[model samples]
Target: MGKSATAATLALAAARTGRSVLLVEVAGRSATAPMFGAEPPGYEEREVYDDADGGSVRCRSITPDDALVEWLSTHGFRRIVRRMARSGLLEVIATATPGVKDLLVLGRIKALEADDDADLIIVDAPAAGHALGFLRAPVGVRDTARTGVLNRQAREVLEMLGDPGRCRVMLVSIPEETPVNELVETSFAVEDEIGLALGPVVINGIVPPLEGLDEPLPSGPPPGVSDVELTEMGAAARLRRERVALQGEQLDRLAERLPLQQLRLPQVFGTTLGPDELRTLSDALLEGVGSLEAWA
Candidate 1:
């Protein structure tokens, strides 16, 4: 996945099919805001993209601190919540507890899932390492706490996460050595360790096939070009071609190893991705996945 770019594109793809989609950023990163040209979202979901058919994409960034506050408020601890926020006790609790932070974040997601505000809730989870921990947090808590509200909450979250119909974890990767390797390991961890149904793997930033590149390079620049510049350009092109070939090999390896559906998104060359680029990627995604109804 291109991370935020991929998340935003997927959300847009769902919204284009006249479905309400909620994009959640669980890594405390703000990728959807900039993609939609809006300010960073807080705990509250805000409409980032509105489809012509009355469907929309709402995005929110969920952090441990904010989730804790929300939890406290819901439990009739508004005064305590304010004091904790002012004294930085919230941060302390979020930091001190190993998996509690992740639990709180998932709790928030569970609330959204129960609310049924959107047809699809796409969580732009953390990277593979932290994401694995996040998904496993509930199970860890459930096992540690024999009896309590915490144990009950953890069980509920675990059920939702493990449900095949409700939850699907999608892994995103670039066609490279390190990222692909990490993705392969992460996929195993998701199914084996986390016990969740893994969804499609989106291979992002794939280099398109370069046509007419089999011919040998010219001896020199065609006109008004220095030898040094031409040589450097040739080297760069050769490197790009080599990288594309290597990426293809990596993709093949991933396909062979993992049985999940694979989708490829071409590398969009641009400094910033706007709606136009996102639309293009979304179309590619729909084409690869077959239909939006399938995702829902």
Candidate 2:
């Protein structure tokens, strides 16, 4: 669904408004850095973009193992956890407890939120399926542990997730059938099961329709062009028109199925996306964000 790029674009858009933004990746992936033409960041935060104003965007990757280690170390169990980690027991611990690993990661994010680490923190969560489990982890852990520090932490994270002022879940999907179907389901799950407020849904990879696609081709080729090229061009245009119509049908289906506002992102033509493409995307995102009544 291109959430990593969306995260980067949203961070830059916020930064342009003189707001410090922290872009976090939870799955240990480094997809966002390349958009800014920067290197992959470790757990430690690195400044990827600095606007001329006081705004900036910092990025970091947070894995469950690393988050668990940091959480334990903060509670004065550094030596013990380090030994367990070395013995490969960490994997066992994370796997044995269904939602503990995810809770640990969310705990770190909660701490950042509480401490006001940045004006905004954008977490690039896992894909749709994993994301549902990711967001529901705190609730599961809280219910499992009736009395303990883990319970307390899980409850706090749950509170943050449910609070509209503190957090909002934004589901991303491309303008296609299967993705849109999954997105609609995920949106309902986030609202009904997780009880979280939703931000605008992001519709990525929207191909703008070409003009004069319906215009009939001339009988003969124009200057500096052959008849064969003209026929091929017409065929390509017709294909594009078909694709645009398909996208429109999917868009309409999404709107009817889900009641959330949408933010549309244009598809980049180049094979690779860089700073220039990122800037274009961020501008489009900013325009969409601005149009929202809540943001306004």
Q: RMSD, each candidate, Å?
A: 2.4, 1.4
lDDT per residue for candidate 2 within 1-296, as digits (tens), equals: 88988999899999999999999999878999889999999999999999999999999998989998898789888879989899998888777667999998999999888889799999999999899999999988888888889889999999999999889998999998999999999999999988999988999999999888999999899998898899999999999999999999999999999988889999988888899999999999988888877731
Residue 27 of model 1 has an lDDT of 88
lDDT of 1: 0.86
lDDT over C-alpha atoms for residue 194 of model 2:
85
lDDT of 1 at 29: 76
**Candidate number with greatest lDDT:** 2
Poorest lDDT segment (10 consecutive residues) of candidate 1: 287-296
Please list the residue runs of candidate 2 whose C-alpha ends up more than 4 Å from where it truly belongs after superposition: none
- Please provide TM-scores, in order, for all candidate models, with all chains considered together: 0.92, 0.96
Q: Per-residue lDDT tens digits of candidate 1, residues 218-240?
A: 87687888888888877878888
Q: Which numbered prediction scores highest in TM-score against the true structure?
A: 2
Candidate 2 Cα deviation (angstroms), residue 250: 1.7
Q: What is the alpha-carbon lDDT of model 2 when measured against the actual structure?
A: 0.91
Model 1 spans > 4 angstroms off? 92-97, 218-233, 291-296
Error of 2 at 273 (Å): 1.3
